[model samples]
Target: MAATPAWPPRSAPRLFVAGPLVQDAQVTIEGGQAHYLSKVMRVAPGDAVILCDDETGEWAGEVNSAGKRDVVLTLRERLRAREAVPDFWLCAALLKKPNFDLVLEKATELGVAMIQPLITRRCVADKLNAERAATIVTEAAEQCARTALPQVAAPVKLETLLRDWPESRALFFADETGGETAAAQFAAHSGPAALLVGPEGGFDEEERALIRAHPMARAITLGPRILRGETASIGATALWMAVSGDW
Candidate 1:
């Protein structure tokens, strides 16, 4: 008799569901997820899969029912508990669709706790498709084997973000004008923090003043050479992960 393949295939699919999960429970996966499993992956009853509720860690389950529009799986065991993600947020000014999408993907891989889209005066893409962004992050987390999904908030104006900034969270502003190196800035501070990256055209003078005046803001320079909006966001996140987060 052949041994059962690992409950979750070596390449486990990352799923986002709403709930508090329990062992030996039944879960019904529907919509695009169902279509992917049934038609794309051709998963059948008894096939193993991994499930995550974004609350209760990762679980190993087997397909109990498979249909065109819906698939049901019964929880067999807990594969791993939810991981503790870094207390870091990427508050970036909206970029063009491509760049913004890249930020969302990489941010998830970097283990950011949240992704806050900021709309500055110079921002190129003020409107964001939340559903698509969520999908991108979900796929990214799955590929990177991340247990927790980073929360993606809707795009808000820069002023609003600064006005409502949480006092306890440090805001590392990547100021293109001038400031300390990112490494030095990160080394000097610790605890829940956020890195704010400006848009493509960069922040206007008025926007810059608002950011600089924010009590929680700390200006940090990426380097002498200017980096693209997406590059700055990813680079800052990577630095923070290495210096402060779980690398």
Candidate 2:
């Protein structure tokens, strides 16, 4: 008897597709994705490629044809269902371009449900390139094999965020000045929660007062050493996941 190879080999390249995936359905891969598969991976007919539709789940796929401009795939079988992300959100103050990009990438990898970019008085940047930010997070999710993508919202003013925040969700404010320990606060609240991180120079006195006065806000500190805006966002998100999320 001859041994058969695994259905989808471990070396298969995973990707997130747009449309819903159904068994025996054909999916067209174009643009950069086509280049990666045809030119980079050099996947020929019958090669396996894993596909994930954010709505459905993960699916095993087989490359049907390959061309310079497009690669067609046939959906084989359902591998896994869409991942259920935690109810946590990262409300991060906008930092420099590179720094904010880092925040978006790591937040997606950490599996936060949503990313809310905040515009604070000390923020270096008041706007975010939504398309660029989406691409960054999408790539990060694809690399991490995430079946679900985090919702990224446009940058909003700090006061507006505080004002519109849901009362049911606990907001853990990462105040540079001081407050309760992050890990402890996160462990104490296992319900729907969020973390608010300040910008480069940290939040101003008035902004700090506003956040502190908000009923849903609970001031928390990362540690003795001060961290940059991106660091705080990433670190606090990871911590919350470990403590209260599906870690």
Candidate 3:
């Protein structure tokens, strides 16, 4: 006889629910998730629904009931364990709203462990909508099939960021003017690391000097071209993942 196919097909809708997902446990999904199941996907009883608890990895579940306001499913088995993401963080300077949204989305897809929004003198925006940002990252993770969600931190001033920097992590500073090659520097480092990129107007002279003077800061350059704020963050992150991360 042929081997049985997977219980939940890859086409099944995936969601990240709160709390732990145990075997044969009932999971009640509400709000927009319910709408997505009942009204959108029209999931029926026994239909597979992939779920991640953000704590216990991914699980395969079957719909027990679908109501207008809620959908309940019984988890059958754990599909996979929580992924091991690279020990990389993106300490990016605040950019325009749309640009920053792209940053959050791509950063999540790129598997950043944490995102620290920086407030600099040249930053166009100093504040971040925490709820909205969280939603963007969650959606991005769902789309990318990432079981582990990156932590989104509140916006912090550059001075405070530098002051509270971890002693062991290497801070790769993407300086527009010039520095060591990014790919080379990333390949050389082996421990916890972070990338710091500037805003639209780039870092001010004082800010640049301060970052460069930090003991953990290793100035790096993307390439010959000077990338835009969003481009720099996204591109540099991709490059880092390919070089030093779990690509």
Top lDDT hit:
3
- Sorted on lDDT, best first, the list reads 3, 2, 1
The lDDT of each candidate is: 0.89, 0.92, 0.94
lDDT of 2 by residue, 101-211 (tens): 999999999999999999988888899999999899988998998999999999999888988999899999999899999999889887899999999999999999998
TM per candidate: 0.93, 0.97, 0.97
- By TM-score, how accurate is candidate 1? 0.93
Candidate 3 structure quality by residue, lDDT tens digits, 125-233: 9899999999999999999999999999999999999999999999999999999999999998899999999999999999999999999999999999989989999
Number of clashing pairs per prediction, in order? 0, 0, 0
Candidate 1 error regions (>4 Å): 1-6
Q: Point out the worst 10-residue segment of candidate 1 by lDDT.
A: 6-15
Better of 1 and 2 by TM-score: 2
lDDT of 1 by residue, 222-243 (tens): 9998999999999989999999
RMSD to truth, every model: 1.9, 1.1, 1.3
Which stretches of model 2 miss by more than 4 angstroms?
Answer: 1-3
